[model samples]
Target chain A: MNPVARLSSTSTGQAAPSGLTGATVATNAAESFPPLGIRRGVLLGLAVFAVAAFLLSLAVGSVPIPLDEVVRVLLGVQASKDTWQTIVLVFRLPKAITALLAGAALSVAGLQMQTLFRNPLADPFALGISSGASLGVALAVLGGAAASVSVFGRAAYLGDFGLVTAASLGAAAVFALVLAIARRVQSVITLLVLGLMISYLAGAVVSVLIYFSIPEQVSAYLNWTFGSFGGVTWQQMRAFAPTLLLGLAAALFTAKPLNALLLGENYAASMGINVRAARWWVTASASLLAGAVTAFCGPIGFIGIAVPHLCRALFGSSDHRVLLPAALMLGGGLALIFDLISQMPGARAALPLNVVTSAVGAPVVLWIVLRRQSFGRV
Target chain B: MITHRFAFTRPRAIHSAPDAPPPNGDESAIRATDLITGYRNGTSRRVVHRGLNLSLSRGKLTALLGPNGAGKSTLMRTLCGLQPPLGGTVWIDGEPLHALSPERRARKLAVVLTDRVDVGYMTAYALAALGRTPYTRWDGRLTAEDEAIVQEAMRAARCEALAARAVAQLSDGERQRVMIARALAQQTPIILLDEPTAFLDLPRRIEIMHLLRDLAHQTGRALLISTHDLELALRYADALWLMGGDGTFVAGTPEQVHRRGELLRVFADEGTEVRRYLQEIHQRWTTS
Candidate 1:
């Protein structure tokens, strides 16, 4: 190789004739025209909507108090009627807050599962967590364990606390089994199939417990399974709120890794993410969330699976920094609306919470699946 | 014809000139000694290529060319420490490759695999920014420096325009470039790619090959690519690692491989006439 020839080539080679350069990428320029501020704007809009839904959930219940009285009671001001004050302060307010927390918890859990599995169809209950909670509730209510305690009693009564604790323990057990399976298998579909199998197994156990129990215990379990946000008292909420907060914190912390996992495990590993540790964190966080919610609110469905898709539809971005908060706000808002509907606007009879959730959530999920659109995987 | 032929010869030396630096210290070259590359079957390890000694130089594009199932991907995986070698040791710079922690290994070597990742709603910018994973905090937030590096990487890969576009919506060529941009963002001394242009059209293939070649010389990074595009590999790569079916490997300059007749011997069974013609043209171009 001639040194002079090489020196000359070095100068001329620096510029290739008529080659594609960074400036020629006009295809992306068309789509990139939308300002990124739209994402922040969308998040702000959802936050405002969430607050409105919270107020609406409080004001439009069975008593149908005006928005003004709801605000007055919330601010500790004397409202027009003491009955209205008592209803808003004692009954509906706690229920609305429960709905908000439960909604956020389940929805974020669903988002994690969908990202981890790289499957759009995945949700919090896909691993049979709800079934696990149901099994625990069946054992508590049908086994005559919870019947001994009065609702207002002290330590003597098992009551809702026993049911909540049992449900949580049951969810944790199922999650543990899934975690073990996840560790052993590398395939996403295999883990999902195993989860479905676990769900069936738990459902079979719950069926057996139902068949052996008395008619009264069966009805009690049935009512609990109807999934109402109203059953959570201020006392129960103290335990429920912290558990949810822990889970939400874990979820938020893993948002970056969740973004990496979107590209699949191999890609995630190349990016220096400890793929196994990330998976464990996601599993533990998701279990803590879905398990705690099911424990407190009887496995309220729809908002968990549907709210993430709703956020994606609105923001059109999958970056979890944006998606996490968006899902939280949207999930809470959706839950508030569903809980409001469950209150039965003009009628005395309240609808089951799951009924309204399924009515709204099922259609969105169906639309996503029917379109066969890619949710990060083919 | 004389001037036209001479024009092609000059670019080769200019591209090859960056190879003079010694690959040591933090700018470590990958060296494998008597390596056995393959997968595990039940309790025992299945050997694909045994007793392999290969060194990928710093600041050069080394193309690993072999037929289907010739153990190209397996060899690369073993070399990169993605999979443990069945028998031998791999050294990165001067340290044992497998001895390094995963985080440390990631900092030293970055990879671009052929696996099509579904990034959902993440933009090209966010995807490329993930290359800073080794340097970012536990929460994976990018610092100002990390952000600047990511932007520069996107620019070098000719994907700065794609920073705002969703990865899912990009064309195959664009996506491949973005994947390379991510590897660039990793800021590793050594970069490995498996079938980087498998799905790309001819023009995009040329662009990627040219981009990778330029990246190796300009950035002074060791780049090892496993590709079936023999023509581009011959033209762009400074060195060639030819894996033969008889469990033997040959490494040399493209001209030297042609001169030694190793290129014809290994590639003889398929495309014999084309390979012969390429050798004839290569012989004339060099000797003239």
Candidate 2:
């Protein structure tokens, strides 16, 4: 620790490859690795937002219960059949939870994508994942005219497991196709363009379906495109939570290999990773996260494309060990805050969630582009 | 006899010492022989080299050299399990290398390929800690033992001073050491480097080679490196594995390598002097 000791220590390196030690077991280098102050700060901020949003989601609505009453009900200290408690626990909680889960899923998917492509602007929706979900949703909503594939021997038609499953299948299909294209194409820019083309192709299909459908079906389909957190029922949540968690977990497990992959496939393979399997898992997890959220919550936007960049800006590094957790908390908190605003308080005119998301997410994105200097290339 | 001692400025004795230790009593180190590897793109599934035999003498430095595409990189990659063999086998100790689990293989062999692929924020120390991943749990939290090894590896790699810098922000030479530090933390018996000095500037490249030499000599570990710098490889390496462009690989002492005309064949186009002077100048050119 002293200057003299430090001087003596440096001089030893010139003499030999003798490691700086006395052979006694020393402190682990990894533990000694300093933690990022910015990341720790961002994490604290996210925790605050999560708690505030959860309370606001319970307290803000047409009923407008006191914050204390909402807290009490959540803690089970008081009982009520009042609309406030009902709305707080069942309607708003489900919607709030949906927003949180959906946001985290999309953000993590986007983070994985940007890293994989080595492109700054890559995101889940930007890479055709949202469109894949849209096609699946359109097929389900407009299928009233035809024989739909029944999930459990009966067609629920408007919103069924068949539809959600179809969305996942569509997303998986698109992801698989994109990955193959990514492999064949040498340039990252070309990959981004190919993804956009896929999105347009899927978007065209959805528009054509909307054009031919009955007015009622067309209306339902239109609402889905605008995006919402209100459609997830308890039944939907039961299935949604597990798949999303599994997909998130899969993405998390790949953190080490994904870090190695940034160098190239050959480099990753040399480190003893199963390159083909890693790519497959990457596709599977991204599609699952994007697909399920799209099917149940509608085709949300802005969150996936922007949250990851924001996370990087906040954390100031690309390490997934930190990025994944930051994305989870930040995405979930932001989504909850957006959902709370979606239900217009005094005015009867509630805004679609996408409009609110764009207002909030866009400025930050613009700021990122404007000051791309602040956040250097990863 | 294998003379694998650290702190050697230059050996007074010619070749190995008259008295050298036996290969060793440990039955779990790497021993390679007659490895053949190559690529299979499109129509051609060309063999890199056939009947190219070499032993990765335990506790010694082994340098593999040849021209750009003479398959030195391919051979190193194959040894690391990234590429597959066209013929012959590579064994770890007395057992088949591939027969071991990937985790087990990681425990025995650590590799530093010539590419930078990290996409996340990591300090030099943290990157070095990843070397302990095979020994750690699935969560990859470093245990007491993992921690001890990582620190020692960092010291050996001489990356302690840069421990706090983000890997993304480090210069090319420093980043290379960070990676080598990570591999050292793995504490594998066999370490393979593929043109580790390629991107490094002169002094940094020599420093890396010196570090590798130290690790092998001190730990009784096997070190194999692929490089285009023939003179440096010839001078420092205990054994030379040379691959010629005409699909021939021969391994022996530096004199044996030259005697086979393998060095001349790979370093020159059909006709040119295989000047020891040219070798020195070419090496100086890289450093300069």
Candidate 3:
């Protein structure tokens, strides 16, 4: 059935109230959604932008490779120089892929958090899951287990596997605590506040661990805190990629429940949704996504909170089915751009990932907030 | 003028059992037997009203009239399964409400709550479309049939013009209509509203009440609205369920309940001023 046509036909001859006649109709007409074609066009544009950004990230680094050569190299044809192949394959490829995965993972996680909590400011880290991961990493690097071996010596021995394991455990601990608290708390705000408190407690423990540790262990932990997309190598991708994909799939599954939740829990319950079950799945999916990214990439900031809002503005719809994909693409695309800027193209020194993220992200978010007069509707 | 535009027409039965007998049949849409409604905190329990029997008949507009804190909301909540009754059984379409699954319960009954809906950036159509949640697939996409129902509901509620507008931008009256449309879209046999007219002005309240009465008469659905608008309830409701704060309960047609002095007894604590006001309105209404 043509709903729009039917709607117009039904409303045309009806004597609508005077107050709703002119200005209301004009304003409502202006606010009417663009057709599905325009939304699809936006999604297509985002996908292209993401692909372009990925190629640009591969092309622009300390040793710049030509775009065609980078494309040829990616396509498995031989490049002009051996070093170019080594540069693209060994260094930039994993890093770009890491940026893509981490960006999409965090952004999707953030979107879930915002919806689940009904808070516009909520992000993947709003629950302090990242703090829990940091605690796990801190314990591994500075606690007695690693104190017995010198920092550099232990790095060679334990590898990234040990750190990833530690981070995952920490995030899991927070996830479990949040879930337990979530079951008992009737209000999402209560859960949000409790998550914040848990985050602070984890951070406090990490600080004390840092204070007691040897200088080398402390320095190692500090470097990890700088956050990087370069840390995940080809070997680690085996675990990182699948875990994030699992989390993303779970997030996509929640699009429907999340949409229902937009009306609040009571209404959702009235509509036959198992509100408790929906909350559990949403919390689990968001925690998994946020936790996995924090495990590999350290606590990358802003992408989770920023990208969802960006997508909402760009697409002009709050529907999760649209926002999730938009967030995934725009998040990856924006992350690559940020990573490229952090690299400074030819500059020898690379800025910390978090620094570049917050610097670029904070202003854009502020602009959106100031212009819209509120964060994108929760 | 707008009232005339809302002239009611009989629509197809959107209920699951379309071929069922007409609503004038004496079957109860919802029945509460020996129901105890109250609040329980841990080991402690506070009973609001106990041993009450109430039933809402199909094709009827039943107004639950009560003064402040007379357990009207508690009773409404219990009937809708938002809260478990402290004792006894509340049945919907002859099935125990508590025993039914959430999906089954939703199919049989829909509720328009007084709780504020703060759905950000959702268009009126999308908000109304959420009524299809119980029926939609995992992804919640609406089928063509579902779309037609939603369109029909919006048309019935007279808010089809507001379909493309964001819910956040709508006035209270407009929002209430959209909410009613959502309940209509649910295609349930029974709809319960908790103070659906609370935030509206007198004209809007009268309009809403008229729309609801017409909906019940035309669609053969049972509607029970808990409201404080006694004058309107007396004028429009098929029956009145009076809940006295002192735990007394009475149910009958407005005139029957008034003749029995249930209205005076329910509002006795409101002092002589309120008693005089009630009697004066009742006298004017009946004499006219």
Instruction: Highest DockQ: give the candidate number.
Output: 3
A41-85 in candidate 3: lDDT tens per residue? Answer: 788999999999999999997788999999999999999999999
Error of 2 at A157 (Å): 9.1
DockQ each: 0.25, 0.21, 0.32
* lDDT (10s digit) by residue, model 1, range A37-136: 2367778898999999999988886578999988999998999999998998898889999989999999899999888888877899887788888877
Against the native chain B, each candidate's TM-score is 0.87, 0.81, 0.91
Interface RMSD of 1: 11.1
lDDT of each: 0.78, 0.70, 0.82
Report iRMS (Å) of candidate 3. 8.9
lDDT of 1 by residue, B1-288 (tens): 001111111222322224334334444488877888998877987889999887888779999998887889899888877778888888876668877777877777899998867766667887888787877776677766666566656666877778888787899999988889889878787899998989899999999998888777766688999999987898899999999766779999998887787867776666767677768867765686
Error of 3 at A103 (Å): 0.7
| C-alpha RMSD of each candidate structure in angstroms | 7.2, 7.2, 5.7
Residue-by-residue lDDT tens digits, candidate 3, B1-288: 112211122222334554344233447888888999998889999999999988898878999998889989999999999989999999787778898888978888889999878876678888888888889889877776676566567766778778888788898999999999999888787889999999899999999998888778655678999999998999899999998879989999988987777788888888888999988976785677
The candidate with the higher TM-score, 1 or 3, is 3
Native A-B contacts reproduced, model 1:
0.31
User: Where does model 3 exceed 4 Å of error?
Assistant: A1-38, A145-159, A180-184, A213-216, A371-378, B1-26
Error of 2 at B62 (Å): 2.3
